[model samples]
Each structure stands twice: as structure tokens, then as C-alpha cells.
Target: MNYLKPSETLSELFAGLVVVLTVTLAASVLGGGDEAGATTALIGAIGANTAWGIIDASLYVMNATFDRKRQLRFVHVIAASPDEATALDQIRGELDPILESVTKAGDRDQLYRSIYSTLAHGEFPARSGLQRDDIVGAIQMFCIALCATLPAAIPLLLSSHPMQALRISNFLVVGLLFIVGYYWAKYVDVNRWFAGLGLMSLGLILVGVAIALGG
Candidate 1:
């Protein structure tokens, strides 16, 4: 499955966070019916924005490391001699587990080297390639995060009808979760309903928590 790039994933999260914070801040400035309500909204907005920003920045750094590794691999493959390429392939095979661990940590170098060495050894070389799992994970992250944001922002934006907007946004987010999850499931040949429902549940939980803490 072709999914979001690491940078793209971070960017999506960042943009959504900005939207949420902006709306929340706006609501605070406009003033709610009570001082406690306004203060609570402001605090929640600040906390959510700060937390999301940190997470987004961390993801961006990880993705950057991953891209750097891929770039290095490309360079290695292009420059290595046939014998050197063979040696690299053996080394990469030995380092496969380490590479997987590094990738999980968002450290791409080992994996990049491994993949490039493998590709260089192949009779037919690919100009560019990405693992299906990595792409799928990125897509999942983006969809899940974006879906979780709507319930928070929509309600804040419609001050006159905050509850109504919140409910509508909740439904919208669920529908989006189902669509994205279904597509992802079908792409991977999994059970579409289960995947969609699982993602929808996660979105609901996030929204519910925000609502509870927000009050």
C-alpha cells in the first residue's frame, strides 16, 4: 500500500493541530457563558496543542532520519562495485534484525543500507522503492490522527451551537474513519468491517476523552 511519507505524515498532524488550537483559542477569546468554562477551554486548548506539537515534531525528526538512510542507501547502491555490492548484501542480511529495530525507532540508516544492498544485488534495479508495511503504517497514522481532531475543533468553532457541531463532527469523523479503514483493509485484503470499526472505536475514544477532560 502506498501511504504517506514521514514528512507528509508530520505535516498533516501539524496542520490539524494548528486548526484545533486556532479554533480553541478563538473560542476562549470570544468568551464562553462562564469564567470556569472559558478557563477550562483555554487550558485544554493549550495542553492539546502543546502535546500534539511535540508529537508531530518527534515524528518529523524520525521521518527525516528514515529519509536520510534511504538517501545514503541510494548513494551506496549507485557507487558500490559488484564485489562490494555482494559483500554489502551479506552484511545487510546479517543486520536485518537490527535494521528492523532501528526502523521502529525511526532510525532509518540500517534499514536503508540493507534495502539498498539488496536492491544493488538484484539483476534488475529499482530507481525507488518503499516497504509496503512502512507506507501502510504512515497512512494509518495520518488517518487516525486527522479523524481524532474533528470532534475537538468543530464544537469550538460553532460557539452558538457548540454541542450540535460537536455531535456532527463526531459523526463525520466516524464516517471518515470507516472509509479510510475500509480502503486500507481492502488494500491489504483484510476484513473491511473489522478494520473500519476498530479505527472508528479509537476515534470515538479520543473524542470522548477530550470531551470529558475538556469540561
Candidate 2:
């Protein structure tokens, strides 16, 4: 159902890619990319990232639920306000930051009034729970994370030498980081060239840190 924003989906993929890339690089450097070390690194990367994917997916659900609860609370507050002015003030205070980038001040004011009218007169259920769409979305998130590791896996499966496979995987992961950054830039309406290069650099720095810590 595409519950995640483009940025969020990119972030998820980036996280998984960095994780496995770190494991692979750390093992290559620390263990001299030996047969046993390479095998261990592959296994560890898959297992650890799989666990991370599940954990991140669950966290997404929690965050989504929290957002829903927050919206409901805001609605209830607006409904219980003493006057229309007070309700509109509260709504504007809570929503202005998000809408400000895309909407004019007059447009935002009108939208807020419309929202105030609808929410003030509406009925909402008390419980805030996960929905079917939420579950589907979480599953989608997990799958994206898992798929991010496939590029790294292919080199490992095809290359006979551990060092060769690790180098290929490293290149693949770094390229992917840039690709995702490019898309992220386009999504956010920025310069794609700078975004791609900047993200590739940032991702390598982050992976180095993670490897150092985990090593």
C-alpha cells in the first residue's frame, strides 16, 4: 500500500546496505579475507541484517501507531475547545511547520478552518491499534531491507576468491548508496548530482564507523 514516504523507504534500504557492507569490509580487513572469515562474514551479515530488518519494521509500526494516536488526541482537543478561535489556534500551532513549505499562509488558514470544522463534529474510536494496512506496510518495509543485501550477496556467490568478492560487493554497495541518494534528491527537489556524491561519501564514513565499532 506504499505507506512509507520515498525518503523513509530509501533510509530503510540504506540502513540494511550499510550494515552488511560494514560486516563484509570489517571481516575483509580484520581477517585478511580468508576463506573461513569470508564465509563467516556472509553468514553474519545476512543474519544480523535480517534481525535489523525485523526490528526496524516493528519500530515503523510503532511510530505509525503513535502518529495516529497523536492525530486523534489533537482532534479531541479541537472538539473540546471552548471556542472556534482557540481550536484553530491549536490546529495551526500543531500543523503549521509541516504545511508551511508547500502552502501559503492564507491557504493554510483556510485548510485549518476546514479541518477544525470536520474534526470538531466528528466521532473517533478510543483505541489506537495497528491496522491491516499497517501490517502490510511493515512487511513491505522488511522486504525492502532484505532486498538491499542482494547485491552484496551476488558477488559472494559468483566469485571464488574472498577478496575479489568483497571488493565487488563493496563497489556495489557504494554505488547503491549513491543511487538511492540521487532518487532521494529528486524526491526532495534538490540537485541530484550533489545529493548522490554527498550521500555516497556520507555512507562510506558511516560504514567505516560501524565497522570499527563492530570489529
Global local distance difference test of model 1: 0.53
Clashing pairs in 2: none
Candidate 2, 174: how far from true, in Å?
A: 1.1
- What candidate 1 gets wrong by more than 4 Å, as runs, is 1-3, 6-54, 66-151, 205-215
lDDT of 2 by residue, 1-215 (tens): 58788877999988888887888888778878877877877887788788888998999899889989988888889999999999999998998989999999999999999988888777665667788777888888889888877877888888899888888888898899999888889878889989988888888999888876763
- Cα lDDT, all candidates: 0.53, 0.85
lDDT of 1 by residue, 102-174 (tens): 4563345455465555656653334334454554564556454554465565554665555444344435545
Q: How big is the positional error of residue 135 in model 2, measured in Å on the Cα after superposition?
A: 0.7
RMSD of each: 9.9, 1.8
On a 0 to 1 TM-score scale, where does candidate 2 land against the true structure? 0.92
Q: Alpha carbon lDDT of residue 59, candidate 1?
A: 72
Model 2: how far is 204 from its true place, Å? 0.6
